[model samples]
Target: MATVNPPRGMRDFLPAEKARRERVLAVIRARYRAHGFDEIETPVMEEYSRLHAGIGGDNEKLAFNVLARGLDADAIRAAADDPAALTDLGLRYDLTVPLARFYASHRGELPGVFRAIQIAPVWRAERPQKGRYRQFVQCDIDIIGDATARAESELIAATLDTLDALGLEGGVVRVNDRRVLDWMLSSFGFAEDERPRVLITIDKLDKIGADGVVRELADRGAATEAVEAFGAFLRRPSSADVPFGEQQIRGALPDGVPDEIVAHLTGIGDAVAAARPGESGIPVVFDPFLVRGMGYYTGTIFELAHPSVGYSLGGGGRYDGMIGRFLGQDVPAVGFSIGFERIVDLLEGEADAVDRAIVLVHDRDVTVAELVAVKADLVAGGARVRLEQRPKNLKPLLERAVADGYTGFAFVAAGSAPADIEVKPLA
Candidate 1:
């Protein structure tokens, strides 16, 4: 038999880790529920084109292609000869594509503006490291068909509260409008075709400092003056007293784009502040430098990050036109995705610190009704119950359960009701 271990970059979460994740997920789910969002599930696999079409930049590169499955050993061996014929399906790149498909198919049944919360695993075939993983879970909440800024603002506020609830402290939710990035780039003298490549380079500013970015522009063949100007442009603090004097930003706006694009951004800034005043619980800022790598985002783009982690816990933005690619009708939308795996990594200590636990009874010939009753009673009394597998010995079971993270135990004899259980507190 082959060695039994999860594939590289994936994980086999032990019981303790699973419980901790569940607790974090519960807190997030509670906030989503409070905000009146419904829950929807999307498949783990989707066709390659549908999943990757609107997914821009590095994400498309990282998608894990699941070309064949259950294809017996013979077929698998044949795939080694011809790989191109293998990319029929892929692990979903992200939740947004699946959500877009779902919305397109069920728009009629859903309310005019649909709000949903989705929690699922997403796969990426990246080189795995301490914080970067090939497989991870995304907890996303998105609202579609409604073009209201208030909805977006509230979602940001709710996301902050949810993060706080989960105990991943000190994260800053950086906000910027893609439209604003468009404005800024045009201000810096970039044409429409150059925008994607330029923004891709600019997105690296945080990882690679200003000098590095300037060097990248030079390498890309941007003129020295243009590169220097672009650097100077990105570095200009939003607080700088330089008024919106020149047509730099304004000229970038497409012909007939109302002045309201700039105005709407200003309004969004105010709404963000008003939604959560003071204390910097999760500070939101207008970063001219926040050019998210994805090409699909058409409006506001945001990311949440911690000072130490240096990568996003998760980030998302308004991809107002994504649904139109499939449905053929534009349905404006905004969303945010929480990186559950990153959150778990950043919060591994929290789970270690938690002391609560439960253990199950071990016995053969126990009546199903008795076992069920016992489980129900403990649950009703606010205790978690973990039923022991059959044919397991008490000593090894107790040791395993404790090592696996259980702080309490209850033993019920075979054919007995839960009322007859001898609840023992395990140390």
Candidate 2:
């Protein structure tokens, strides 16, 4: 027999993994609903064009294209040399793309300000390493046609609250409107066409450090002065520093700046301050350095990451014109996605109520009644139940149960002879 295994960067989500994931998703869904957001689902697979068009820089590199299935040997042989000619569909890269299409197609049916939560699997082809997978889930919330700074502020608050609810600690909601980043880059002499590249490099700031970012900018043909100024902006303290007792660096804005971007930044900062009250430990401050790389973000952009994970958990921003690409009319929108795998990693220790195995001993046909009774009881007591075949020693059975994620093992044996039940704690 040929050995079977999951594809690279994906895993067989055993009972335990499935249970823990579901538990977390349930909480997220409930929280979204509490805030009056309706649940929405998009297809797992989408057309290649729809998935990649203007998603962002570098996102195209991660898309996994799908070829035709159930083809005969001749068809496979004919197309073996060139696969691109084989198919046009691909697994969805993320939920946001389908969402934009959805908004475009169904704007008339949806509410004035459509609020929705999408929890589903997304595929990427990046190198799978620790805590990074090619196939994973993204939990997203999108509100279209609402441009208030409070809407963005509420997203930050919701992100914080969701992480808190999941029992995760030391997470930060780093926020910076794209306009602010654009202004900073423009100040550094980067033109409008080059801003996306600049933003992409800056997005890696947390991982690459200031020196690395300077090198990246230099490699992109940016002037040495531009690199230094950009690094300074990243290192510069926010205007909020004055009221919060942090050192103020370059609090004074330089002359020759666009007033629109400045006003937007100040307004967003005020909203963040209001959302995060005094000394709340999770302070949302203006970091002109905080640049979300996605090209689609038109206004305020934000990211949430675990301090321990050392990578972004998820992010989103206002894309007031994305829907217009498909509908030919602007539909103002802002939204964010939560990387489900990243979140699972952060909360793995605290997510304990997962799959529990119930060992069912089949002594004979009649013994199934006791087994059923025990299974029922266990299920009623908030546990998952399963049947096990009987053979005396019970040692291998216990071992198999443990391997199958039976946190609380229950051995159902033939009874009514004594009605004496023994619950043994497996150590």
Candidate 3:
């Protein structure tokens, strides 16, 4: 027999593990609902054109494309030279793309300001590591048709509240505006077309230190003077020294850069502070160098980080022009996505106690009807019950049950009565 295994970067969640994950998801779902966001689900697969439409940034290169099925040899041969010609669709790399398609298709049916909650798996053909999977769940909340800074503030408040509810309080939300980044790049003499390329390099600042970023930029043809100037601004020794305040940022940028953009960043910081008051420890601060990797973000962008995790827990931002690509008219939007897998990994040690009961039949003659009745009774009393034939040694069976997360057990024999089944606590 051939050995069977799950594909690379995938996992099999046994019952106990699945239950734990579902419990965490429940907390997230309830928190989203409490904040008046309505749930929406999009297809796991989407048209290849939509996935490759330039909105996904670097993630587009990692999409898992699906070739058309039932093509004969000649049909396949015809398109062998161009793989994209044979591919009709691809698994969605993230929820934002599908959400944009969904909103554009259903805008008439949705409210003027649509707040959506989506908890679903997204696929990526990238190398997986601890807490990073090729397939993972993203808990996203998006507000469409809202152009004001209030949309960004509400997303920040709701996302932080959700984290706090999951016992992930005190995390920092590092925020930046795309416009400010654009202005900064322009000030360093980068052209409008060169800004995206420079921003992409800058986005890796957290992963690659200042030296690496400067080297990569120079190798990529960024001017020496421009790279040095940008690096100098980004290499400030402390957050206090970084120009984040309205006055400070205005002084750093060119004269014509909008002052309102500075005010917007300041307002978002105040809103976050007001939403999460003293001792909450959830600091929301402006970082001029915080360039989210996604190219679609139009205005305020933010990322969530925690001391417990080595990477960002989740992040999102305003994409005021994305929906227009599909609908032919612009729709202002802002969103935040929680890294569901990373959050679960962080909370794995604090798993909720399992309340399951396993029934072991000591005698072979325990009838099917009797076993069903006992199981039904336990289940009716809100217990997760499992039935098994008693093994030669009760100790080993009980040990296995305990290890498998069964909290209680019941022993049954040939003449056992359903009413008499007494579940004993394991610990």
User: Which is the leading candidate under lDDT?
Assistant: 3
Model 2, poorest ten-residue lDDT window?
A: 241-250
TM-score of each: 0.81, 0.82, 0.90
- In Å, residue 314's CA in model 1 sits off its true spot by 1.6
Global lDDT of each model? Answer: 0.75, 0.71, 0.84
RMSD of 1: 5.3
- Cα shift from native, residue 272, model 3 (Å): 2.5
Residue 310 lDDT (model 2) = 68
Q: Single out the weakest 10-residue window by summed lDDT for candidate 1.
A: 240-249
> By lDDT, is 1 or 3 better?
3
Per TM-score, what order, best first?
Answer: 3, 2, 1
- Residue range 181-240, candidate 3, lDDT tens digits: 888788888877777788888878878989889889999998788998877766755434
Over 4 Å off in model 1, which ranges?
A: 54-56, 66-86, 234-259, 277-282, 351-380, 386-399, 410-424
Error of 1 at 389 (Å): 11
lDDT of 1 by residue, 1-427 (tens): 9879888888888877787788778888998888789999988988877766755456877887876656777777777675445567888868888899899989889998889999988888889887777888889999998786766776777787788777765667776778777776676667777777777788788789888898898898765666777777555554433222123234433344346665665555567667667664326655657887777888878888777676788888898888999888888999998888778777777755445456766577777788888888888887767888545447878888777777788766777776677777776
**Position 175, candidate 2: lDDT:** 62
Clashes of 3: 0
Off by over 4 Å in 3: 235-257, 278-282, 356-362, 367-370, 413-419
Candidate 3 RMSD to the correct structure: 2.8
